[model samples]
Target: MLAVPYPYLIARMRGLKRGNHNYYKTLRNYTHIVAGSPFAEKVMRQAYELTGTRIYKNTALPFAWDLLQEERQQQIRREFTNYFPQSEGKKIAALLVFGDISKMKKTPFRNVNMQELADSIGKDWFFVTNSQELAEASYVLPAEYRERFGFVNRIMPTQNLLYIADSLVTNNCRFAGSYAIRRKPVHVLRYTGNVFEKYVQEDYNDMYIGQIDKEMVKIQSGQMRPDQQAFCKEMSYDNPKEPYGVIGEILTKPF
Candidate 1:
């Protein structure tokens, strides 16, 4: 069967033995394995050395491309505003795609004070985050600012909120790759997790939160421009064919 491993798995492979690890053995069973970016491909190659495993492709196919279209972005903005009316008059900033409280210990946001972040971000912005994240900080979050933070009880896909958000603040998760497509400013909290060195160093949109307000203003005002093309290159978006077309060719052809 074809396998499209998560980007993190590619990073983790760096710690595995060259040819003897169970994960590498399991990977051997797949007819084809895909890496979503050049950074991922490099890691996979280094980790899988002497194991007879190789990446079949490097393409970013899983991103929400349709959502980035202008018409769709407008529709999403309307839908988002309808659901969170507090966002109607204000610029929206989002904390994205985190799951359980226990899992957070592994990321840079583990020690971040969400209440302080909220207070420091100023009054012109409304914040969106998951319920669990809100609850994790709510006890300490002031009552007046609590209204500025909104969340849905049910599962709200990160892309919809991302489409309308003026900026994003997130840990180094795969979902943060959407910055390449969205071309917005993303303030990445610090963590030296297992990831490509170039991926962390070269991307223009990713930054620390030391002076978040000033950084945000610079980004929006074009003083700090993000190089979308450079970021896309890191994601291996160089293939001339559409990503779906490339995937289809791989699936239908002899392996």
Candidate 2:
């Protein structure tokens, strides 16, 4: 069973409380799946049973889009450039592929074109709605542009897709992670208990890795900028024995 940290869950609930009208509407829709009417205890129970946590089903997409907004996107771009200055002048592409363009149109996926977007960004970024469409888009791109573009397929299993999508948003709209393969096709899977479990575990692992990264920054603080050191400290791991001991062992080994 996937267990989100209590703080994360509480923060999500707080966001839900402050969400806009559409967020509530989406919540209401999901709440209807249970025995009782929306917002009833039975509905909540059903939600817990299905997802292992209470979350507004519809809020994730909008939240993802919010993270992809112009300001956030630019911030992400800036961070990326700062980290990889050599990529500063490179074009970032974004492509969106969809199983049913019509269905996407009804949602935030409306009017987004993979090719046009790639051209607009003037970067090696691409977003695709589905794997098949991504393949098709890759085939049609101009030879020059093709080399600079990267594709993001959205048709992963719903849960995995949402997790990836959320990460993309949280990570300044960058696409990462893997989706399942089906006969060479890919589909987004809806969020599920197991998927959520994996998501939490992955996040925890990322946090732990980030902590270790911070310790490295501290060790190199004399060489790193003050601001960089500060940023690294925030991500520092709580348990340093493992890392410290490993390094000590390596350095002291006779072999």
Candidate 3:
């Protein structure tokens, strides 16, 4: 697992912080965008700063946040070495999970379609449900090249699923883990949402931070086994639907 440096964009946003309430509010909104918080004046301001328009107010904030995350992923790839082997001489196939995206009603399987779109662009492509699906799907390929493509299980969370999906489209090998075994001309991108959100709080210097730090230390020292990392990846301050949350009533309209 190569560590990608946090984007300077984040640091630049954070640098705008001042001790004043207005400044803090601005910072909070900027963080909200990254955390997929609902729309607010502050969030709108941050979006304008980044995109020069208020397009996100009309679009879903999760999608907007995903775009930002994709940009960050690109930055990571640019700065880090290739982790997966080369795919120059072989064709590739991808298997993606249709998780919550399938439940969206409006954009179900949009990501899966995106994968097909990538394949149409040039790369040989196929889609399957699981490892067994891979085996069944393989028989459809030409006999000479039946072994050139591989299957990947799409049993991970959404966030990790996108990472693997991005890797497949870009032909980045660093994310092609053990699924590359058998030299079957295939690559695998397993979804791992176990560490989806960590460190999503407003105050990192508070007692909560100390407690989190202690838990992290325990995990690092092998004294504990956590199902997921101790971190908050999303912010809910602007979401009116969230319990005990408050964003301005004016911002809650379905405009």
Candidate 4:
């Protein structure tokens, strides 16, 4: 529906999200793709086979690191520690592998092999989800060798744990973008396997890990221009055009 009138809207910016039918349906019509993350770009490219000079002609711009402040993030992490054990030598890791409860078939949990991750990491692991009831269940574990997953009730507070922890392991869920935008590293799993690979994959695109680290290092070290943050906001060009571009191009170049 948005694709019908988005071009006429002044914003002219389109954001591709997870599990949304509209973005998938209108994939071919878009000329500029402002992906939530470069990982999304790979999914779209694999699913639709969009070429650089053809559809999505403009280079996709990443969404900014729009999240809570440092003090607030720390608060959430501290609260997380109350529920789980403390980290000794290695940093604790939080795993968020669940997605839309209404669509369980689409989640990576089905084939993720949780027991394997629990065995491999062999460290403090907190399994987070969007479900509240499950979170309560996680808290009351038998205090013995309980299930390998600890549960979190809220997404925001759970993500705050991400900031404090050393790493994150998620599927094609939106949280991957959280780590990406913040310049944090997240080890993505083979979420959803081939079921939705064309639409979403957890592979390492430069956006997810490599490039993000270097840029974040620059910001921390003050190697960036003083006005880099401000300049980034102004340089966000989404290749705007009249809504007619979708139709006009088809009519003009049917070949």
Candidate 5:
């Protein structure tokens, strides 16, 4: 079996200072480590120097992120007909909340209460996350709007959900890359939260640095950053094929 670790555990394996002891030691037992992204490969190489096929080997190709076909989009619409009807009055927002992190000092919300955000944005907003975010949000959400903005426990072809959304906000959220590639307007918040906030935090990063107020106004009108085109192009892969076929060829054929 192959070990395909994402950035989650890779960033945690560390030693005293110079090198990563955990990855180096553990890598000795595996035939190969399949890195999903260039960032993941960089993280792995930082943890341990790549020796050969036995230690580490990467195809260097990102996972297939082809554009969502029209049929698939239609199917998703049909599957979740209630959530999205005609897509006119949507004002949809996809908040990728991994962990609450509201308690953290530098968080976007900072000292603000979670429930406060409920009143800030209009209706038709929803969250896309597993159990962790769902549990974190249960307490802070205002009771009246709970059913208005529902939660998706899980969705097959997860990218479909992002396609339906007009805006995406995330904080160190793992799947933000997917959203960027889909050409959907993505906002990587300084911290993660289930409740989507329209308040633009300019000091958070250089992306929203100078024209933050203006950008906030634009975002309110459902316009994405003009600079995100390159990002979407670079990160997206239109190929429908999986890399597993290459893995099989490599194992069977001599080189």
Candidate 6:
């Protein structure tokens, strides 16, 4: 069996001094490992070197492809509206919340009140979030916002929802890369959360820089014009093709 760890984990490992000793050691046993970026590949190679284990074959590729078909946009929009009737005639903005780091009692996190953020952006737009985000938000988000926003509790593909969404709002979210295929306006709220904040406190050599506050006036007005090409390139998603086919070809044919 092949090992394909999440790229975020690999990035976190790269941020660490020794790349989490035992984890990479165990990864040596896999026949092949897939890396999502050059940085991720570098992390794995360094880890294998430290363990004195032979580094297996691996390739760095974009995590997701352009699954947003042009023809399917309307179909997806209609399907989305069935679930989120309030979203009709309003631009959809996806608020991606991975974990409630702000309300945690374990450590002091820069207070991130998502409620206020959502309220500021939802003037003419409607919001959507998954069940996990909604659950985490219950502690901070009030009932009005919760009731107003659409909750995708089912096993629907996120790409489909994003296909219909006009903008994205994320805070320390893992699947932010997936949304990069669309190259729409994205507001990155939080990055320094979880163990990353700890790394910052210890004054370690951290590469993860926190980007906060996109202009709310532009974002809410649907006038935000970010460099789409640059953002896609940063995520290594400029080409946007199915990754599995590329991986298969890489395994079968020599470079």
Best-performing candidate as measured by lDDT: 1
For each candidate in turn, give its C-alpha RMSD to the true structure in angstroms.
Answer: 5.8, 18.1, 18.7, 12.6, 7.5, 6.7
Model 5 / residue 156 / CA error / Å: 8.7
Candidate 4 lDDT score at position 157: 55
In order of listing, the candidates' clash counts read: 0, 36, 9, 0, 0, 0
Can you rank all candidates by TM-score, best first? 1, 6, 5, 4, 2, 3
TM-score of 2: 0.26
Q: Judging by TM-score against the true structure, name the best candidate.
A: 1
lDDT of 1 at 9: 53
The 10-residue segment with the lowest total lDDT in model 5: 195-204
Q: Rate the local accuracy (lDDT) of all candidates.
A: 0.54, 0.30, 0.27, 0.39, 0.45, 0.52
Model 2 score (lDDT): 0.30
The whole-model C-alpha lDDT of candidate 3 against the native structure comes to 0.27
Per-residue C-alpha lDDT of model 5 across residues 104-206, encoded as one tens digit per residue: 7664433433344444444444433333444365556666646435455554444456656667655432455555545666665534422212122321232
What is the C-alpha lDDT profile of model 2 across 190-219, one tens digit per residue? 112223223323433321112211221222
Model 1, position 116, has a per-residue lDDT of 65
Model 3: colliding residue pairs: 83-174, 84-173, 84-174, 197-231, 197-233, 198-231, 198-232, 199-231, 199-232
Provide TM-scores for the models.
0.63, 0.26, 0.25, 0.42, 0.53, 0.58
lDDT of 4 at 183: 40
Q: Estimate the TM-score for candidate 4.
A: 0.42
User: What 10-residue stretch in candidate 4 is worst by lDDT?
Assistant: 1-10
> Over the stretch 1-255, how does candidate 3's per-residue lDDT look in tens digits?
011112222332344343222223223222223222221333235423432222222112332233234565454333221321233332223344222333344432222323223333233322222335334545555643343344334333323333333222111222221111111222212222111111112322211111211221221221211211111111222221321122233256355
Q: Higher-TM-score candidate among 2 and 5?
A: 5
Between candidates 5 and 6, the lDDT winner: 6
Q: Which stretches of candidate 4 lie over 4 Å from their true place?
A: 1-68, 85-90, 98-116, 124-144, 147-149, 154-158, 190-255
TM-score of candidate 1 on Cα atoms, chains taken together: 0.63
